[model samples]
Target: MRTALTEMLGVEHPLVGFNRSPAVVAAVTNAGGFGVLAASMYSPTELDAQLTWIEEQVGGRPYGVDLLVPEKFAVSDPDDLVASLRAQIPAEHFAFVDALLDEYGLPAHSAPRGEEDALDEIAAAINPAGAQALLDVTFSHRIAMVANALGPPPADLVSRAHADGVVVASLVGQRKHAVRQLEAGVDVLVAQGTEAGGHTGTVATTVLTPEVVEVADGRPVLAAGGIATGAQMAAALALGAAGVWCGSVWLSSEEDITPRPVKEKFLAAGSSDTLRSRTMTGKPARQLRSAWHDAWDRPDAPAPLPLPLQPMLAGRAWNRVHAAAAEGHPGATALDTYFIGQVVGGFTELRPAAEITREMVEDCTRRLRALGELADT
Candidate 1:
């Protein structure tokens, strides 16, 4: 359990749990692992509130925040960020989304009570000016690390984090990316392969881990993708990783905030049931196959838009889908899907986040010891 990651982050286990739920983040951190909250979908105010709540729950334990600072995104008027982004979305795409919902027999979507600013929240995470505002809020907190998946952290971000004595980490799918991130002065590199949820690449973890490790020049590299158990964690360490970065596995935890309907779909799904589809984020992200994707695959379906626009369009549709599914509507239930990984097939039951964290660390230690004994024999 004593690796560079554990030592750097001052945690007992070399595990990094990435999820959006503050409760899950606090639980993982308090259970002796570093928890990183996914902050890409929240407005600056919301993120600040969530981080504040996490601090209160963890009681000074170390945790991190992950952002979606893609190097390339649709440019919009900073003065009217939400409206500019929304206007860029073609009317035809809106029609397609509406027709798809009607085809699924879903009713008009209503934001459940206080989530009226959902689209604004999504728009803020991807817009440059808005991301800067979020960063300003992030630095005002007591975060131990900051992470991004799209590419190397902006030079100013690295400078800002370094000035604050915070660790900067980036997720890489190729050796070339590792080299760039190192040059950008990132302290940690996560070798996130295609098997991971959300935005990812086509490389396999078994292959990408060592490649990134080799180019990392002694920087700590965490192996991600298809890692949900202790044996897999051990395998990552054996591949020269300092630790593991897990996201999908947390979806099965009781503390995870993913909609219960989506969790049910994840529990019933097998490894093969997931696919990399661009219909969701306009990037090849892995998610459970659903009727929404099936509809997109049809000949008449419009091609998905780019980056922020795609999510802006899909976010509205998802609100409706989730609202209907929450009411036990069969059509909405069939279309309910969320980002997940191949390890989902291994999920059999929901457990507390602390239990999951402890089990993985203990099991990994035991497995490594057993392997060492076999070698001696």
Candidate 2:
């Protein structure tokens, strides 16, 4: 229960749950683990509102915010970056998305929401300017930490967060990335493997964890990817992780905002039912295998566009697919998928977020003790 992560964050447990829903974040934090809210999906104003709401629910418990700050992206003038990115998306990509929707017999003729709304959607996730705005808003909050989801935190951002007495963390897929992040002055490193739900590298956790731990040079490293149970958490500790950074396990929690159709798919999925596909985000992220991936993976299908463009092209279609799936459309259901890790196979039922946190800690304690007995023998 007492690892560097727990001590550094001042939490009762070393389990850090990263989720998009404020409810789940608050629940995990209040249940004695550090909860991190993924803020890339929100605009500055929306993030402010969500963080304020989470603060009220958690009642002074420490929580963190995660932002997608990719090291490489298509460069453009900051003022017009969103518009520039939007313009770069090829017409063929849009046509491909439309064709897929049409083939499924879904409505392909929805009216445009508006140019401003479209620009906002594109900028919110991939633009550096948007991420900066979100960081400004996050610092205004009582956040305990800030994590860069894709790569090392920008140097200025790290300095700014440090000045405000907040710890900065970064997720790394490789040992070299871990060293780069530490050099960038990150306070913690999350060594995520390919089995992780969202953006990840091809390395397995079992290999990546120890490699990162060795290179970390006394800095704390959290093990991620394919970790869902207490035994796995114990294994991560045995592998030299300060703790575990878990995301996918929380998706099946009752407090999670995962769509019912997507949740059903996750619940039914086996360990192999997921795949790394660029169909969701331009980057290869692990998501439950579905017809959506099947379409994109076809040899004849056009290759996915880079970064922001790919998400921009498919974002609207995904919204429509989820809406139709909610309405009992089989085609939409077939296409519906969400980011989840390989540990999803163990998610047989929905439980409260608090209960899951407590059980994981208790189970991890028991498992570690059992291992100690084996060592004695």
Candidate 3:
């Protein structure tokens, strides 16, 4: 309970929960774990409002903000990148999506939305400007830390955070990435493995966590990926992590905003059912292996558009598919999917965020005590 992360964030536990919902973030932080509200899914203005709302709800509890600043992204000039990527999306993809909808026998839209509107929606939804917007709000608020999910925080961003006296952290899938982030002057390293949900690397957590700890050179390292249980948290700490960065386990919790159908799919899914597919987002993100991934990964399928474009192409279709899935439509069910890590297999029930946080602490304490007794022997 008094580990470096808890001390750093002024929380009661070393657990960090990453979620997109503001409610879930507040709940986790109030429960003593550092709640990280993912900012990639909002525009700058929207993120500002969300962070402001979070500040009101959490009542000054220490929480953090997460941004997606990928080390390698398709866009060079953010604006031109958005524009060019918009033009590159083929109309055929729309046709395929429409046909899929028809197969589901869902109500057809009276008129199709324009490509620009669709593109702008997705870009705005996961735009980099959201990161800048969140930075502005976080620096203005009592945010304890700022994290970059996809890569090292940009130099300017990292500099700004440090200048504001906020601890900066980045997620890395490999030791090389950890070194790169450290050299960039990140305060903490999040060692995420392939078992993580969303974007992840291929390395297993059992091997990657210690490797990252070794490379961190005493900087705090949070082990991520495939760590849902308290025993898993204890294993991460025993493996040299200063804390645990958990995401997937929270998806099925009561505080989580994940839809019921999607949550059910995750609950029924095993660790092996998910796949690393680049079809949804431009980069490889692990999601429930559904017909959507299957359709996109087919040999004849067009290569996924770049970061903002691919999401642009799929976002509306996804929304429609998800709505249909909620209605129990067959075609929608084929495509309704969400990201969850391999630890999803461990998610046997839905509980409150506070209960989950408490259980993790209790279980971790028990496991560590057992290990200490073994050492005494």
Cα lDDT of all candidates, in order? 0.90, 0.88, 0.81
Number of clashes recorded per candidate: 0, 0, 0
Task: Tell me the RMSD of model 3 versus the true structure.
Answer: 2.4
Which residue pairs in model 1 clash with each other?
Answer: none
Error of 1 at 376 (Å): 2.7
Better lDDT candidate (1, 3): 1
Once fitted onto the true fold, the runs of candidate 3 whose alpha carbons sit more than 4 angstroms away are: 71-83, 110-130
RMSD of each: 1.6, 1.5, 2.4
Q: Find the 10 residues in a row with the least total lDDT in model 2.
A: 115-124
- TM-score of each model, paired residue for residue: 0.97, 0.97, 0.92
The best candidate in terms of lDDT: 1
Order of candidate numbers by lDDT, starting with the best: 1, 2, 3
**lDDT tens digits, residues 136-245, model 2?**
89999999999997777778899998899999999999989998999999999999998999888999999999999999888889999988889999999999999999
Q: Candidates 2 and 3: which is better by TM-score? A: 2
- Residue 226 accuracy (lDDT) in model 3: 85
Worst 10 residues of 3 by lDDT: 122-131
Candidate 3 lDDT over 119-156, as tens digits, reads 46546435445455556766877788999877677788
